[model samples]
Target: MDPTDTAVMIENYEAFRSEISLSKEDVIRELFRQNQDRISIKKEATAVRNLIRIIDSTLRLANSKGFHAMTLRDLCADSGLSMGGLYAYIRNKDDLIHLIQNHGFIITRRTLLHYTRDVPDVRDRLYAAIKAHLYLSELMRAWFYFSYMEAKSLPPQEKRDAVAIEREIEAIFLGVIEAGIDAGVYQPRNARLVSSMIKALLQDWYLKRRKYLDQNVPVDDYAMFVRDVVESYLLQA
Candidate 1:
């Protein structure tokens, strides 16, 4: 990735983390210690839910094209909401951008968490992680593509926040690689660089999948090819 692209990824990662942290804090404040009344808590929860739906729908659509190309009408049509209804949730396109970027990271992190549970062996864990990543891209192909392409259009602050979330996800991959090395299942290399390559492979599935499918490639077969490549390049002798 170029410097600008790298910066955006890091911002996405940070935004994701910050949103999670805020959400947790809000829940605790409202429910745990009863910092807020029941009515207020419920209202806040409802608002968050609506906002999430909008962001999720928007990200799913935006990834298929350049962010600049997506308009309010596009968002309205994709989300099945009126223009006024959309504005009630967000002030403008910039706010929508922040929401979509943050939502993408949050959804991705949740998916990874679910996929990583109860797997003890490092190699299996890494394989499972790659599988989960690929499966998610398949499932949320539109959102994945939208976040990758439209993230640059976000405001400076939001852009930085989004990059942070992206970096966090990358770090998770790097950690898996490092764990495999320590467990003697993989060879030592630059974990960051290898992680990037692995991510690229996964991203290419959504970004350039038509070519692969045009060649009559099945998802399982493609995943196996990726698994084999990682094994051949990174496995210990």
Candidate 2:
């Protein structure tokens, strides 16, 4: 699904807020000014929210198997919504795939934003980003795994957007590496390559968590392992 379609829906939903007697006229006017249309923003927002829920539930089910293994009937059952209702939110399975990919990016961006806020030093920011990313994956393990693995199946435009979001995330890691080098904290090397490696290490925990658990690895221990590797590789001499 095109993100703009969702955006337009959200804008329309916002416009619907004016129906409430308590809704401020000024607020509604501002929304109209920004959107240039008094569309049913409330309904659109609700539909978008439902769409996200559908994506989340479907991905959770798909993680046990794979995307191709999941049917629309499976999604309908998993999401606890009828086929008609589900279709109202999305055109088809392909649309749902796009929604899930975009939703993952939205969630990841929100998580990183919280971690990076108010952190001045680049090293601290990087630490916070890593911790946030790992913690979020642990908390939303199925969703993260589904997003990572199912991305390849998205349509060309959706795939490009997904890759762009992934690259942006890697750039955050690269920024830290570059900072470390500039501050004489890290050895001169390819920051992008190092960033990719760091991401792999972080992702491997959730993706292959069974292996780690079989070895009796605790979360704190896993986090410490990441910190140690990063510090050893990136810290100043």
TM-score of predicted model 2? 0.77
Model 2 pairs in collision:
12-40, 12-41, 13-40, 13-41, 13-42, 14-41, 185-236
Local distance difference test, per candidate? 0.65, 0.66
Per-residue CA lDDT of model 2 for 1-237, tens digit only, reads: 221221111112123223222322222233233332322234645554455567667877788768888888888988888888776656677776665665566656655664565566766777766776776677667878887786777788878987899899888788877987898768887889888988999999989999999999866567667767887877645
Look at candidate 1 and tell me the lDDT of residue 105. 63
Candidate 1, superposed: residue stretches over 4 Å from native? 1-53, 56-66
**Tens digits of lDDT, candidate 1, 1-237:** 111121111112234344334443332222222312211224565555555557656665565555677788888888777887776656677766655655556557765655554567777667767776776677667777777766666689877877887787777789888988887778877888988988899989999979988999866667678878987889746
User: What's model 1's TM-score?
Assistant: 0.73
In candidate 2, position 235 carries an lDDT of 64
Q: Determine which window of 10 residues in candidate 1 has minimal summed lDDT.
A: 1-10
